[model samples]
Target: MEVLKERFGQIGSQSVYSFTLKNDEEMEVTVINYGCIITRINVPDADGMIENIVLGHDTLDEYVNDPYFLGAVVGRVAGRIKGGSFELEGQSFTLAQNDNTNHLHGGLKGFGKVVWDAKVMEDGVLFSYLSRDGEEGYPGNLYIEVTYRLTNDNELSIHYRAQSDQKTLLTATNHSYFNLSGNLKRDVLNHSLHLKSSRVLELDKEFLPTGRIMEVNDTPFDFTKGGTVKRGAESDYPQNVLVGQGYDHPYILDKNHDHEIVLKDPESGRTLTVESDEPAVVVYSGNSLKAEGDFRGVPSRKYLGICLETQAYPDSIHHPNFPSMVLEKGEMYSSVTRYKFGIED
Candidate 1:
């Protein structure tokens, strides 16, 4: 294993640094302190050729100006919070409404837009940030740490730890648009997706959870048995019509003792297995991703990549049946999500 650091750029007055971690399998991951964003991920394909499979910008300036979240760590809350207000312990707190009429991904300037204090490890990098109390209308001084590790076995592990001075809501996940074909120009619609989830959170027209948990057995949202992304997207189901573009709903994962989801690109023979302790995984098919700049010299387009974001259910604060997103004082919050990459035999 090897670790290398380079000056990425300056975000405001803060100097951003990029840390590169390479393992024996020739897999390399570069992460920048700014938003703890993953700048690149290089892995070998079927032909033994290594290429970056994750969507990312060429420079720090592009990332700063990008809105798609690209390859950054999403936080405070990973998904939508309806109305941008939630009552906690008799107090009603309202957050910044950044996504239409809802509060999306923490707030206007969430964790993804902030600089974190980074520490290089032998096989990974640890990023720490302190979210001040009342920042973005939250109710606590929260301390968060996110560690990205690349193991020799071709696994990228993301570990999160957080604590708040007061009761607050917290959920975090990595928003990495993956194109296993190693070609950003090619859409991921042809990729085979298998999710170990039997149900999904129903959403309204605005993309907020409708407080309904529907079964995926006979719906287009079903990926229990595995199928191509295009097959699901082309289904004439009502949910598909409501979502319009592709899979953006959060699937309720089955209780499994192994990885919850698998995505494979037959062209490159590359497979990605996602395992997480979280209760749900939001499979976003990059429906609205039309970035202005080039991604590694390739033009960015819609459906070119997909995001399997593992975290708590969206709007969990309002749904009592869903797993809680509350982080109380003196309690340690921890979660783990891993992505293992390999070529199918």
Candidate 2:
């Protein structure tokens, strides 16, 4: 383990620090203290050329103020809440209304905006944060610990552990936008995407789940067999058009606890395989990126990088049919997700 030297002076007044950890195979990862963000991950392609596959700005100030959710850890609760409210047992609760008619990404101040305490160990780096009761209009005083481990075997593993003082929902994940080709200038539409999900949690016009777990068999939402992201995106796919752009719904993965979704850029020979223990994954195609700003990506228009967010189903707190996201007093809630990189010949 070596402490990464801070060469760039723009890390800001937030006491930024970087750590490098090498796994058994000799791969290296650079992690920063601010937002507990993974600043850079260097991996080899088919030609043995190492490249940084994740998108990010050069300074802490950009992430500190950016609302794009780029490469940042999300949640107290990761997805949307219908009507920005939910009932627990028999009590009705109102959440912060960041979205016009719903609660989006834990309201105005999410875990992404908070600075986390960092600790460097021989294996990797650990970042911790504590959310007070009703911090974002949610119950429970939640304590969260997230660990990032970069292994020599080409895997960037993330472990999430949380504990709540009261009964409250928990769904946390890292929102990393990846363009594996190392070309920020190109759209990811050419990349082939394969999901292990047979069904998707249907969402309404506003992107909230309709509480129905619809089968993806005959629908365009089916990515189970693998296909280019743009295949159904241009067709008359009902879910496609309903999402307002590309993917933004939570696909119910069909793996036995730990399954993977793979994406490969044939041109760049870069591949990304995401494996997780979390029950569901939210596949968002950066549809909201076209909002107009410097954050509009390098060259391509909208639908550039694809997001595979592993977590509990969206609006789980409001849906009784969905798996429980509840963390009762003294109970520990934990999950793991990994992004493994390699080249396909």
Candidate 3:
């Protein structure tokens, strides 16, 4: 572990920090303090060359105000809340509903805007943030901690722990746009993708679930085995098209002890395998990405990075069938997701 560089010094009352962590394989991980973001991750290609795969800005200001989700830790609650409200035990509570009719990513003052307290741990760093009751219209006083462990084995393990004084909804996930092939300007349509799921929640135009959990079998949403994203994206598949011409639905994976999502960079031969204990994962392709002008990505243009976010289903509080997101008093909430990086032999 080493401090390669500090991204920002002091901007008025705000302070930001960025440090680099190198493992035995020479894989480098740059983490930022603001929002506990992962600024960059440089890994080796098949031929033993290094390149940054995660999308990000060169300056801290770009991330501070960036709506791209870039590399920030997202929560209080990760996905969307239907109608910006939920009914729990006959009690109805309304939320800010930042996303049109839904409450997306914890509203306007989400975890992305808050600064996290940082500590240099043995192998990586730990970022912590506290959410007060009614902050962004959420309930309970919540204490959350996220640990980013960049291991020598080229694995980035994210561990989440939270506790609340009162029972409240809590689900946290890191929103890092990943383009493993180092092509940020180009779209990720050609990348090979595999998800360990057979059924998934269908979504409406607003990206909210349509209250139906359908099977991915014989549908374009099927990525049960490895397949390209554009295969079904171009078809008339109902859910695939509604997912904004890409992948943005939460797949209910099979209950096995294996990895859930595996992405292989055909050009670079860099493979990223994701395994999580979470019940479902939201696979969102960068459909809204624009690469026309100066705001393009690294080597590729728009829609290059894809996000595989591990968490409970969206609007879980309202869906009794989905796993519970409520953190009761005296009870601890713990979840773990790991990304193992390697090159194809």
Candidate 4:
């Protein structure tokens, strides 16, 4: 394995770097210091053709202003927090309500939008950022570390670690929009996906969890057996139609199941298997993607890609039954998620 760094772009006079982690097998994953964003994941297909799989921009300025979150790490809290407020340790805290009445993806400027201090490693790169005590309304000076490693087995693993001076809410995940069709040749509608989840949290009209867990028995939301993504993206079911035209719900992860999620581009014979320790995953069908000028010239439309964000359920603090999102002071918070790539037989 080799790690190479290059100039990405800049925010003012500060220089952002892009680190490429390449294995002997011709798999290369490029990540940038700004937002610890994954700019590219070049892998070989069945025919031995290598191409980039994840959605990204052509330049750094595009990423700095991107609203889609593209291939960045999202945090402080991974998803929506109701009304951008929470009570902790007998105190009340208010956050920036960027998403209507709720807070989405941390706040106006979350981890995905900040430049992280980076260190090059023998096998990968480590990105660290210190979130100030009052930054984005969180009550902690949180130290975050995100490591991206690529091994000879064609596995790209993201390991997250964090510690804070004050107890705070933190759930981090990589928000890479994947379209395994190589160079954006097609949308993800034809891709077959299987998520080992039997239940998904019900959401309100505002897209916040309604505190109810709904079973994914027969609806298009059920990917327990595996099926085409189009089945859900184009379904007329109420939940399918409720959130745009596709899915944006968090599915409870069945911990005992093998291969928590699997995505395949049948035409390219490319398969991606995801394994993670998080209790839930937000399977976004890219229902809100609407860019056409930045994606290496590919016309971006709805369902252009998909996001498998493995983390504790968003807004878990409000739902007593969901997994906890609190990271105590001096307590270690760590989680690992692996994405293994291969050619489907």
Q: For candidate 3, lDDT tens digit of each residue in 1-345?
A: 554646465556878888678888889998887888887889988998888888887776677667777788888889899898886567777888788888988888688877778888767888888888888877788888888888878999889998988777888888988888763534577778888899999787888877789988888788887888677557677666676567788888786349678988787888999998888888888776665433233443445788888888888887777778888875889888999998877
**Candidate 4 segments whose C-alpha is farther than 4 A from its true place:** none
Question: How far out, in Å, is residue 304 in model 2?
Answer: 1.9
Model 1 regions more than 4 Å off: none
Q: List the residue pairs that clash in candidate 3.
A: 184-300, 184-301, 185-300, 185-301, 186-300, 186-301
In order, candidate lDDTs are: 0.89, 0.78, 0.80, 0.91
TM-scores for all candidates: the values are 0.98, 0.92, 0.94, 0.98
* Model 4, span 1-345: residue lDDT tens: 999999988888788999999999999999999988999999999999999999998799889878898899998898899989999978999998899879988899899998899999999999999999999999989999999999999999999999999999999999999999998999999999988889999888888899999999978888999999899777899888888888899999986336989999999999999999899999999998876554888887888889999989989988888889999999999999999999998
Superposition error at 158 for model 3 (Å): 0.6
**RMSD of candidate 1 to the true fold?**
1.2
Per-residue accuracy of model 1 over 256-319 as CA lDDT, tens digit each: 4386799999999999999998999999998777755577688777788899999999999998
Query: Which pairs clash in the backbone of model 4?
Result: none
| Cand. 3 Cα-lDDT | 0.80
State the displacement of the C-alpha of residue 334, model 1, in Å, after optimal TM-score superposition.
Answer: 0.3
